[model samples]
Structures are given as C-alpha cells and as structure tokens.
Target: MEDGFNIGDIVLSKMGRDSGRHYIVVSTDENYVFICDGDYHKVAKPKKKKMKHVEATGSRSEYVAGKIAEEAKTTNTELRRAIAEFEGTENVPVQQDEM
Candidate 1:
C-alpha cells in the first residue's frame, strides 16, 4: 500500500460516499491521510482517509506545501482555492513556488 501522498498533493477518493470527489492532502500518517475540500471537509476538521482509498492526482500546491514545510499557518480559503485552481473550475490564482 504505497500511499505516495504528500502534503499539498491533490487526490481523489476511491472508495466511499465521497468517491470521485477531489481533495487536498493536508497531512498523513503511517496508514492514513488527512484531507480537506475546504467546504464539507475543513482544515479545522479534515477527513481521515485510508491511503488505499485515495488515488494521487499527480498535482501539487506549492503554497500550501511551503506553509506546512515552514510550520506556518494554512487556511481553509487557501485550500479551497487550491482545489478550485487544480480542477480549473475557478480563476483564482494559486501562488506556487518554483522548487
């Protein structure tokens, strides 16, 4: 069960009522990952999902990643925009760092 999940990475739910819904990876553990959509799943209360239950989308958010790596603060609005930017559903610009 190689999760291959990283903070700020985008993922898709594979096995649950939320299946097909895209979310952002906020945190991870040995066996599970915490995700937030910034709506139903807020950063204040992310959803804990099994690693195998999610499929990595190969997309990442540098802004959120930077905050986590720096131990700085991350907000739900940022998360929501990140998701929207990835899904191309919104025109909100996501600040991404070139790493």
Candidate 2:
C-alpha cells in the first residue's frame, strides 16, 4: 500500500493472533516490511501481505519528546532565574557580542 511504514517506526498489529502485538520496523522494499515483534517471539524478517496489518506507534515517542521539551523549558527558566539573581537585577544587560 502507499501508506506503508518507514524505517525506525514502531507499530502494533491489528489482526490475527498477532493482534495487539507491537513491532519495530527494520526495513522495507515494496509491499512488505521486515519487522521485529519482541512480544510475539518474532525476530527480524519480512512478513507476508495481509497477514500483518499494523498501525504506527508514534504516541510513545511523541510523549517522550514532549517530556524532554518540558524539561528543557524548565531548565532554561531556572538558568535565567539564576543569572538574574547572580547579577542582583531582574533584567540583565545584553552584550552585542552575545547577540
């Protein structure tokens, strides 16, 4: 299909006994994909068509990325606060070199 998976994406199978199984995409050529479904005891191999229907598992990585972004925001804010306190002023003077 035109919407087949790309490399490095995680997916969950939606049919057969493999239903609800999670897999990681290893590679793809045309209509099939090489995948590793850890929970299903499947190692890296290209699966057959229609036997494995998968949906992308992007939410897991997205949630982790969002957490990292939040942490970065908190760290940036704290650094600004620390600089302000060290300089004994709420606003620090900007340097032309820094700009």
Best by TM-score: 1
Worst 10 residues of 1 by lDDT: 90-99
Predicted candidate 2 versus true structure: per-residue lDDT over 1-99, tens digit per residue: 336566545566776676775555545666665555322333322454342477776522332224334643222233233334333554764322211
Candidate 1 clashes between residue pairs 3 or more apart in a chain or in different chains = none
All models: lDDT?
A: 0.86, 0.46
Q: Which one is best on lDDT?
A: 1
**Candidate 1: regions farther than 4 A off:** 92-99
What value does the lDDT take at residue 71 in candidate 1? Answer: 88
- Kindly give the stretch of ten consecutive residues in candidate 2 with the minimal lDDT sum: 73-82
TM per candidate: 0.86, 0.45
Task: Estimate the TM-score for candidate 2.
Answer: 0.45
